[model samples]
Target: MTEESENTGGLARRTLLRLGAAGGAAAAVAAAQTWAWPLLAQRGLVSPDGAFAAASTVFSDALYIEAFPTSPLILSPFNDPLPVLKALAPVPKTVFSKWPQPPGPGPGQQNSLRNERHQVWTSQVGLPDPIVYKINLLVRTHSFTTSQVLPIDKDGRPAVSFDAKRKTYAAGTKRFLPPSTIYGFNGGFPGARINAEYGRPVLVRFENHLNENPLNLDRQDFGSPDLSFLTHLHNSHTAPESDGNPHYSMVAGPRHRGYRPGMFVDNLYLNRPAGNDDGQKQSFFWFHDHTMDHTGANVYKGMVGLYPIYDPKNGMDMGDETRGLRLPGVRTNNPDGSFDVAYDIPLAFTDFRFDDGVTIHKDFHDGQGEFPAAKNPATHPEWWGKTFYKHFPNHGFVGDICTINGTAFPVLEVKRRKYRFRFLDASVARIYEFKLMTSTRGPKSSASLGYNGEELQGQYRIEDGQQCMQFNEIAVDGGLLPVPIKRDSFELWPAKRREVIVDFTRYQDGTPTTKGDVIYLTNVMKMPNGRKWAASTRFSPDPNYKIPLLKIVIGDTVPDNSLVPTALRARPPLPSNWQSLLDNRLIFEVQRGSAGGELEWLINGKPFDPFHALPSLKNPAGRTPLAQQKKGSFNLWELRNGGGGWVHPVHLHQEEHQVVMRNGKDVTRTPDPGHPDDISGEDTAALDPGESVILYRGFRDFTGPYVGHCHNLSHEDHAMMFAWEITP
Candidate 1:
């Protein structure tokens, strides 16, 4: 059979298994009764429930098993891989410097110098010496659960081992499952956290060590084929070379691929705020792989890390509750050169699908002949329970399991005081709307609740009758808001950051939260497929559907001094005549193109041309370049959604923007109730269906090619992105 046909067959088999588990014929009848029945019938293999459908037809002979249950309160601070160095012992070299006169211009071209355009400003500010850090990307094993007991199988037996001898474990067998392989930063999951300050710049030498794999694990069919990498500090204001965009990696190239194995690139981050304005100082940022056409796979493999910048100049110290906005935190410097802030936590939400030990590892690349298919789909019995990823998911990929800080279903203990929580949606396509909830019935198993099939994916342990709790939202992806806004829940899209201060001392209703009180961090957004949210708090919110992600237990009260001020940092003023620039605005529309499957995502009816190698889209038969802007120039740009029933979290690299108009409505003059956060400066433009936003942005300080694309990594990797250069 054709690979495409086999793909469909794979989905059908998995669907049948789900149907049987949900009570066989009765469950199918009930599924047909729902409103989604028609859509499900049309798409035979796609799950009506919000779980991933198998993309491979071959099923493993090994028995089906569930994820081993993990204990609560397993959340702990991750260790920094290496100590922070005070000085650069050996001067870092660039790709260009390594090979003076390399090859032809393509992927190997180097545009900027080691320090690039920001060196002058960095020195002029008389900032302290830049901190040097060495980080390596290599393969390692990570455990999702800490359970020692082997998970039970569908036949009431411990899952059979993948060993060639075919040994089976007895019921209630106790043993640790094999860890899944991951390409991590510094050879660890969640990478390393860098606690930085605005005045202290950072220089990171990222060395690619992906070529080494001592474990000899089956390196999956996803990720960059060449094992090359390009690291982009999402939303950071820096030079193009350090920005890690594909435009820089492929330009003026001697080595037209990415920073390959054994090569190192020095990324200099000038922590100074854009335009030297304190209001422009960002709070949280992350760095991850942005290799052309392989971002989703690379990130899914675990190349993600965190960077939280503190504004010490304005009393907004790192964790001192007595100063600045007095947010919740107590700073602790680790002897291992790592840093931690008590009461302040960064939660990265990611999802994943594990190998069932049955389904074959198949994807679009395999079908397209870019990679060879497995000789025997069921041969890799050892892959059971490990993370499974598909390179090209037409509807976009969303995981069946939810993970926080690299651990699945983890719980945190909190002191009965205010705490600062930084939320990041690191999933490939899933968009999460989170709410703090209190449950009277406590946690229950999904099997007991009659949830089966893919529905049982991430909702293994759920809370009963969850009630909402309110919190004070203090910041967003850009930085602090003009003022703190009280919210019961908020939507976090891919690559978007939302900071909230939750006071554990008392509930929203003024009831005191004593020691041992348990609260759950629940996700209310329902996305059956990555196309869009089936139900969201913003539009069609489903009150009954709540999936508890992280558990929180209250402890004894601590000394309270943090204050939620009425006035936070002031935003830079926009020109009164900002509206005048709208007439000459650069308009770009993101929409589905005429192509099928993996090639449909497009910007202005054109796929991204990273090398500027394609013909211009302006020509009748061409589809190349999309945008360009002059350096040091301020202009208005409009991002429009070419309605395809999909929502897009559009991200623009390099600079944050001020939204003036959304859907032709002047939000600057009047607030948008649907999007209250529009008042804050943002780097991402969250566009709902049939929406368009007009932003006032500056292309300043440096000049080079950057990217603006849908933050949905699946959409981005599939070509729903465009390149725009800042001309000098």
Candidate 2:
């Protein structure tokens, strides 16, 4: 949107709301377009069930996923092997030099130096052998990769490839040329994927070229803490050390300033050939720097990647059976026509645009913070994270522009045979709904969005009032958590990824000219955080800026016969945990906010104290990592929701849960969090304004420090999150 156009809209919306404010009357307000209307209705800002224009097109398709090396949220098979922990590094450094000279000038007045402190790791997966995979985590020194590799050693890091004349990284490398957005990550975020498979052991080595920042720079200001990274094979994440826990991060490199492990890192992460059940087949999972305050910059600078672990034992590798269906394959192949690439392909999808001249000021004395990029007072207004962002020619934040395989709408050369597309939503906060555009006459870049659950083969129904109840909406910050931003350009919801398969054989033509299987995978992600980006806050919902996130233009291509979804399933069945809720004996109310000397959170309306444990009957994990303290061995524990600002996803890390009492009622229709494999599904009742709901969660496995917060990443980041111990 242009400046003038935005200004006009802003004035109009604000004026409408302000003028409508009259005494003893409902305000004729104009809420943020993207905010949820249902929430507005509850707040009395708008009438209930108001007509809302379709924000963006919807989708319906069964997505098949393949797990691999890295991850979005690592998903693994149950039989997966234990993880193998190895220390590899090309680790970056946080270099510092004491000002005044030392006693004898022993080392030329050098006071201190430390390797960059971002958590980086490389893991390999092979169906048979442990192969040597060279993984490159070349973080832009002081991270200015979006502008390409700026040669200047700005902020004390190496600027080998950047140009002094242009003040930006070289125009373009192989993947990045022109008309493409530049973000962080060495060879693009999520790096490149080679060969991987389920139930196999492999090794990935890091070429640590990260040097010490001579000019002194804070580590956390740019990317995640360099010293904080864990190679979670996602589903197969084993060892405690490799778990990438916020509290258990470690550093790697020639430098040994890494965090210590109180116990053997014994999750799947520490095993050699990692294997763990991913629970579900068609979803996205991954790995990242879980360090506090470092998540934003680190992921922004490309320290994130995908982990698509496929269950080979499952019928997942039957792509050839579905002749027309394309299968995404990242399998370790034997090459030749006899190799595993038969009908498999890999698509590591991620794109990031950078703020030009990005810079950070820090006192290498200790990894603290950084200086925000400079701003043009006349052009750019002061923003939150902006006060610390330092860089020139900022490209600004883009949840819109997409680069599949490091290029916008990149074309893949596939054989006449079937192929698979392993998709991962690596964006910070965007829910994507993508479709493989194909038509009989030709290819179209759009899909038919008729979310009428009626068009299904089986009569699988959750039948509300009988089996489950629907969730109500809650609004905060003058809006809802999922700030609805759906349009012709993009749809990006926080942390939503989809995996789809495309078959070239079905299309008959590749593009307009070639009559072959040439497919265009188009994505329409919900971009709510756009407002957050503009306001320098990714959590709070605001109606200030609207932007398109991503668009796919095939130019010209032939369509395909049809696209097949993994399963025509809607919601899963509700678990039976609710039956035991009557036995609850312990209950607590959790709240969050920045307090005390550092940031703080609370439980039962009280700030969280590390030395304290909310009263509970038994340690759910029996002392294992999944050993969370159970409210009652029978039925004494309860966490009732007191409708407030935001609705936390309230995930119990070790076990799944189900809704039992929503605002004081036994709603059979609520989803069964522990219900396993019964099509009679349900939706978990959501917390309504001033409402109380009851949920039941049974003990599962390993007990360790787990976080229960809003699935909404933004809220979780801004202190609306907390942690608990499941100890006896």
Candidate 3:
């Protein structure tokens, strides 16, 4: 069969299975595979989808559902300006003295000024008055969409609804589904934004309230089985005690896995740049759960929060467009005491799968005989239409539904003016290549377009000829770029952040956008099962595929003041003798290990051993410790992707690095054509298959154990992580 025919046949089979004819479709596919496999192999046209046809068939038959029943109509309207969380007042000294259950330490004993480990640094740095806030981790319910859908009970019956007005499910006739259970920060999904600034340190007393379950929902099998918690501020240059890494938690703080319920920990974020350098100021960060062996599960369960730090030094002020680079924003102090910056939005992209009311939610842990089979069953049927998760997905988990800012397929109304968007990919393994496109024809159901299963993730698509809008990318995971890059599209890997300035007033072709014009933040990257991208616009474009994740409606014109500057923050210059350190540089390779469950992911052929250091490539005999670095020193570290047809986004904690070499090519002198943004300082390295990157990194300010791991949470949770330390 021709490639076109094969493709058409596969789509038809998938559609049939999606329509509930799975038995017949599977039989036909099984019968044909014996003869068709050879032909497809001979033609070198064996697709990733075809290779995993059985799993795809099972998913389409029972686990698949359209993202939403209705098209754009059901999409939640985006909350204008987003929501800002109010900071809680500091607890009184008398009340703070009895934090632990048995009251271990008094106020003076635990205070940052009095604590021996932090007293010297606090005094030496002349730390200003800290902004003390309290945050809690609790089990709560979250709604992904505003629309109501069918929900099933434990006995496979339509769930009974409890009306708040009537106060009784028996009196209520309307059937309403229960909200998905989530372990959230302060009882909020995506938590609430912490609008922070440089020069002001933040001292957060994080309390664990996960033991409380007022909603009485059956907690799923995912997340830490013990309900312990550890919060990490991603890529922050903080001391080990506040880093929230498992290395420090396991060795120093708790001397166990994580902080237990009813316990609280004081995390002091100095909010200072690395090496006290003005050039190293970072802007965007996120705090989330980082418990060992459960980071992915905890994060997926909604234990995540956003932090956007601003620089108020040297005219680079926050939201005061008149003085600084004027990146689109207007500061507004709310009556509730929370601050908000209009037009400066944080869009966190996450993916999820809802139970189809049939297929059981199962993972490697369920069948591994670790838990009692009958008493602690991993499968749940009463969670119909609620979020479903698999703890140990072989190829890593990629959800079938896409959400931004905790809402699926949301719509945002934008004024015909410039706006600054901080984009974050919070998904487990999915990588997104996003573009702003205007479609002549609006959203249509994916079923009408012959797409099924994961293809129906967005539920709606715009198949008409869509024109792309350009963006001025001004920042990456680290911070502001040295110069802005104009691009029609850019890829965002898991845990990676990209900031862009978009002018809704006009298109790239100089056409003025008018009121009522609709634009879509579309995703064009096609990732079938998270092993890797099936298609990407940067390399191989899929013309027929584009999922509209967010709808942007053009509104009334507004006065413009923000400027996309030609030059932004400058990166620290490398030492003239940087190349001399290459010979002694530590090298680590991330790759697949023995196939099966969590053991598949590995770095340097070993699982995560926080207590021991892994030897560098040059010291294979284990004579030298590569994971230990001296404070106040700089070094070159090479990260290699041991080929397995997979992409790994490697993230290093504490300090951002400057990429000097890519695959032995000098990227410092010349920017990489495929990744021009590599010239910018970044904490995460996006490594394609078989790619190698040499990074110039620094170890400074504070000391103790930290970690470097794959930003793909699943990979990190499994084994693709290593512990490193900075010695005094």
**Candidates' RMSD to native:** 9.1, 17.3, 9.9
Number of the top TM-score candidate: 3
- Ranking the candidates on TM-score from highest down gives 3, 1, 2
| Model 1 Cα lDDT, one tens digit per residue, 1-728 | 11232132233322332333333434334544464455555667455332112211111111122122211111221111112112113223344236452211233222222223222334656665456667789889888767442443433234443432334444454555467889988876687777877888877778889999988766766677668788888888887777888766666321333677877676778898777778898899988899877899999999988887888886775677888778887776666544577777888888887654545554435533344434432334556557777765656788766888777767787888888988888899898988888888765645446655444545444446465568689889889998999998889989999999998888877889889988888888878667788887877876656787777888888798888778788888889989777666777788864322223477776666665522223322232333677777887878888886888899998899988999989998575887888888888898888999988898877877788888888888767777778887
Scanning candidate 3 in windows of ten residues, the lowest lDDT window is 64-73
Q: How do the candidates rank by lDDT, highest first?
A: 3, 1, 2
Q: Give the better candidate number (1 or 2) by TM-score.
A: 1
Winner on lDDT (1 vs 3): 3
Q: Which tens-of-lDDT digit does each residue in 232-253 have in candidate 2?
A: 3333333223344442232222
lDDT of each: 0.69, 0.30, 0.73
Tens digits of per-residue lDDT for model 3, 1-728? 12232132123221321222335445435533665566556656366434334423333333222122111123223333333344334444455456542112234332222332442244458767556667889899888777543332322233333322323343113343457889998889897578778887776777889999987776856777768899899878888877889888777766555787876777778888998898889899989899877899899999888988889896595766777888888887655444678888888889887754345444435443223321333333355456777766667888766888788767788899999999989899999998888788777756556666456655667777476589899999889999899988899999999999999989888999999988888888888766789888766888878888888899999898889998999899889999887877888899865332223467877767777666677633344456889999998899999986888999999999999999999899788887888889999999998999999999999888898999888888777888898888
Cα deviation in Å at residue 61, candidate 1? 25
TM-score, candidate 3, is: 0.83
Candidate 2: Cα lDDT at 224: 34
Clashes of 3: 0
Candidate 2 has a TM-score of: 0.48
- Say which prediction, candidate 1 or candidate 2, comes out ahead on lDDT: 1
lDDT (C-alpha) at residue 7 in model 3: 31
**Segments in model 3 whose C-alpha atoms lie over 4 Å from true places:** 1-121, 148-177, 333-338, 367-379, 596-598, 619-624
